[model samples]
Target: MDFFNFLAFYLYVYKFFLPKIGRVLLFREKRIGISQQGESTLEEEKSQIRHGVETLVTEALHISKGVLGDNLTQTSQWCEKKKEEIQKRNWKAINGSYISSIGERALSGRLAFLPLFPALPPQILWSTVSSKLKTLNNTSS
Candidate 1:
């Protein structure tokens, strides 16, 4: 199959079968004092996911820069300026609440939302870059 189909299958196995299997194995090992290793394994998985997402974002940004040419630099500068504005806003309480909600949902095995989380940043970046490129093209023409 193609890449996206393969990805869907992989995520299916990861989101559904893997967790169930891990729980079952951990339960069986619980009597033997081996259950503590599961926490480390989960942490490792999270780290890998974080790394994969970062790599995806980097690749997407590279592609965008190649496509947008000079406009991307201007767009990135604007994004950086907006980032400072965003950082000044008080989002601590909302951010904490959102994090806890996702955490609770993830722990409960409702991974339906998991696939969308990693895509959001790249999608937002693409839209922003594309919009800026369009505006730049219009102005130049």
Candidate 2:
């Protein structure tokens, strides 16, 4: 399987385990809390809570990286860098164009990202749906 797809599937699987891990950690803390019986200082309590949080985060990251492996992690980073490079090049091309007005240029940039719907103008889709609903209402009445 492709790395991205495999990574997504792995994350989906981990979603179930991640919460279970958190609940286990929280239960452990509660047990610790009961055992301490307020004997621990405020700073100590804070430290324990912080440690719990850090452990949870570390475990989550460790799980992600552990399954994906360092090479896949590096590949993901490389893909992100390439995506950024392409976006920068595209943006430069758009901004450097001869479009005189700022508003027009901005609109062109916006349209570039928009999916094409050549079959109908934007308003026509809404108007068509509304007309169909009106016709249905008339027939029902």
Candidate 3:
């Protein structure tokens, strides 16, 4: 019975709920194209993108909290903390590169799979440490 419940939950999340959320998050048009904009204008555009990404993440995390449990909520909090650290840096210097890199990494890295496969407990632990190391390496260099 518990196994069936888990299976149903997994199927629902993977087949229906997550795909809808992904469409909202990944398909949004946040780019304004390559134009001859000044630094301040470019920075404003990047900030809007960052805020959109953050909102998407928050909504996804809320869904995960309802479906998965505290583990995902904790993981999301950790990611947000790392993001805050990056944001606290010189925005003029970082120039939205960090947010873009974070988005790329999230899509390519294990974080993308964690919510889809809650049965793989060890992967969550491994991915968390691996993600932290990658963030540190990226920030240091």
lDDT of 3 at 40: 68
| Cα misplacement distance, residue 118 of candidate 3 (Å) | 70
- The Cα error of candidate 2 at residue 60, in Å, is 63
The residue-by-residue lDDT of candidate 2 on 41-104, one tens digit each, is 7668899999999999999999988878977989999999999898677765564343234434
TM-score of each candidate structure, all chains considered together: 0.28, 0.24, 0.23
**lDDT agreement of model 2 with the native:** 0.73
Clashing pairs in model 1?
none
CA error at residue 138 for candidate 3, angstroms:
70
For model 1, where is the 10-residue window of minimal lDDT?
105-114
Using lDDT as the measure, name the better of candidate 1 and candidate 3: 3
Clash pairs, candidate 3, are none
lDDT of 3 at 44: 96
* Cα RMSD for candidates in order: 43.3, 37.3, 45.5
lDDT of each: 0.73, 0.73, 0.75
